[model samples]
Target: MTTIELTAEEMAFAGKIGFYRDYENKQRSNIADYDTKRFNLTSLQAHRLGVMCEVAVGKFLGLDMLKQPPEVWTGFVVSEHYEFNKGPDILNRFEVRRANVRTSPIPLRKKDLEYSAQVVQVYVPYTQTADGISVPTQCELLGWSDSVEDWPKAETPSWSKNGQARVVHNKRPMSDLEVMV
Candidate 1:
């Protein structure tokens, strides 16, 4: 397994802080039907969070982000469309997830299995206090499993929570990961 180190400041500056701020501003704006403003906001937040994790993970691995296609960029990769690659787009490619028990199962459909990555990395972010203050803390690499078979089974149905679909499973604690920071 490959590991990389990241300082607190670097992690803090990567992804979604500003986007969320803008979102909050919109929430308070005097617009028609403001109650529906939260529409699709959660999914957007999740997507942004995933991108943030990918940025950190890619940086930690010492890979050049400029050379990689944006997470949603369309193009060819390994004989297939780049969008075909799900999860984290790092080193050997991985599916990134925030630390949550319900999200442990990797969703690899039968057809998607061929295009799926072998690693599943979960990142637990440091908390931001309500006082508008956040203690600088390193995002934890909760755990990873290299077993492709461990990904969610295609035939097994997934569950939904907060309007998001998730494959649930009991994952073993993160293995001994060696990070060279």
Candidate 2:
């Protein structure tokens, strides 16, 4: 496992794509526009940011996002609409979840099991400003159970505001987890 700590510049660059909650729907926006007018962004920018984060995580893990496994590479070759697939974002098979703070738990949807058999969780911690702009700070490889059955047992049941089933687990501490770069 490797650890990658993102620099202030990298994080700030990632912050260009931002999100906001409008009533029940979560809206995307450009940070620059938000700073001035707090306007929403097109779906294109949101999709691009998702790909960027995935690529950044893959690069940190030493995998070339363009030349990795078909599944991983396919994630990068997308525009307009984005597809949500099961498993990790990188070819190394570590399930990656990005959170606003280091202490935030990784919330894995109950139905997604594509990468549940994998034993490692690449938890990326990021920081966001008061206005909802954010940048990823660091990545940690959390060694979890290999058995998919163990995952549900390890997580605490919770429901999203929209009535979706989910589980959250704190797992190992950020300091104790191995760093992957």
Candidate 3:
């Protein structure tokens, strides 16, 4: 398991970006009408994790995330073609998903998989805060899944409060990912 550790400043910056984006999305009413995300986190928490994980994935692969954070969706409709950056986006493409280090499958919803060529599963090493946000100084690069669109999936129970989620199994180990370039 490859580990990418963020500095205090990186974590704080990620938190700020996540909160700011959520605030902007709400201000513009870009918050979706239907969110099929598997986790129980508030939009703010989710966004924080999303941005932080993406940044970590980039570091794990020795790539660079966008120097500037992404702009808010111009319109309320964030369709497959119009969705924001999913992850590090190596030529093969990737979307980072958070899961428990012990037992969590990659969270690959149908719509989310469409835009991603691969799924990168990440796990934060520390316990989440009571306030429901967990910004990790170190993230475990558990592994990844290529051709995940065809992976077997069923509603499976998890440590998440939302319980069962339809997800991909048998992701390749992180060792396989490093040579993927």
**Model 3 ranges off by over 4 Å:** 27-40, 66-92, 128-134, 152-166, 178-181
For all predictions, the C-alpha RMSD in Å is 8.7, 8.2, 5.9
| Cα-based lDDT at residue 75, candidate 3 | 15
Give model 3's TM-score versus the native structure. Answer: 0.65
Question: On residues 28-108, what C-alpha lDDT tens digit does candidate 3 reach at each position?
Answer: 543232253545567787667766776788667665454532332111122332435343333336666777453666655
lDDT of 3 at 101: 54
User: 71-143 in candidate 1: lDDT tens per residue?
Assistant: 5321122224444444434533454545433344543333224444434455544343555333233444545
The candidate that wins on TM-score is 3
Per-residue lDDT of candidate 2, residues 1-181 (tens digit) = 3466655654444443222112112444433212212213344334334444555666654665545544554442222213433445444354554333444555554433555533334544433456643434655554343335545555544424333234445454334424354
Q: Estimate each model's TM-score.
A: 0.47, 0.48, 0.65
Q: What is model 3's C-alpha RMSD?
A: 5.9
Superposed model 1: Cα runs more than 4 Å off: 1-9, 16-48, 66-88, 101-112, 131-137, 152-181
lDDT, candidate 2, residue 54? 52
Q: Positional deviation of 75 in candidate 3, in angstroms?
A: 17
Prediction 2 global C-alpha lDDT: 0.44
Whole-model Cα lDDT per candidate? 0.42, 0.44, 0.59
User: How many backbone clashes does every candidate have?
Assistant: 1, 7, 0
